[model samples]
Target: RRNDPINDALWDVYIARSTDGGTTFSANVQLNDTSFVTPSNGRLGEYLGLAVDSSNAYVAFTSSISDLPLGDVYFDEIANSDIPEPGSAILIACGVLALLRRRRRK
Candidate 1:
């Protein structure tokens, strides 16, 4: 990223996925479509936060745009075909079967 005078050096948010138990990682994809300017007053933070649901990964970070004087928080989510846990899959199957049986009784 190139340095900037008005805003801090231009920054971008990226994300990567690992499927083979951290053996290999997917290509880094920039999450933020727009610009992500760093805070000028002080350090933004030590690390970024990431949360993974059953189907998607969510990331949060600090970013300051060109218009605002202060920095603001930003977040993004990316979807992936995550494998469902065995217990969860069984629960879903049971729920579907119960619904079907109730409909048949009607």
Candidate 2:
């Protein structure tokens, strides 16, 4: 989830694992090598796909990176062991509750 009021094009792909049944998540780990700007139609991009097996996760997504002006699909592989354990707590907005934003100071 992004809350930046500036630089709307600073789109980056990330993955955060939830260990407690989605009640909390590990800090997001960036999956993309470069930042990009997706289409401005309130969508991150097209063909954002995920395939998971017993030991790893695979991701395929699109990006229009700064260096690569032409958009391209990128693939990433993450080993299940590489995902960090959730040490702290942060709720990722999901489902019908996403529209209800809240504030919490650290």
Candidate maximizing TM-score: 2
Residue-by-residue lDDT tens digits, candidate 2, 1-106: 2533475446667766665656766776777666666644546534476655556767777667645655677787888667677712222121112111123358
Steric collisions counted per model: 0, 0
Q: Return the lDDT, model 1, position 35.
A: 60
Q: Summing lDDT over every window of 10 consecutive residues in candidate 2, give the lowest-scoring window.
A: 92-101
Model 1 / residue 28 / CA error / Å? 1.2
TM-score of each: 0.59, 0.66
All models: lDDT?
Answer: 0.48, 0.56
Q: Which tens-of-lDDT digit does each residue in 1-106 have in candidate 1?
A: 4224465456666555554444545555566667664577645443355666556666677777546677677776656543221101110110011100111135
Cand. 1 Cα-lDDT: 0.48
Using lDDT as the measure, the top candidate is: 2
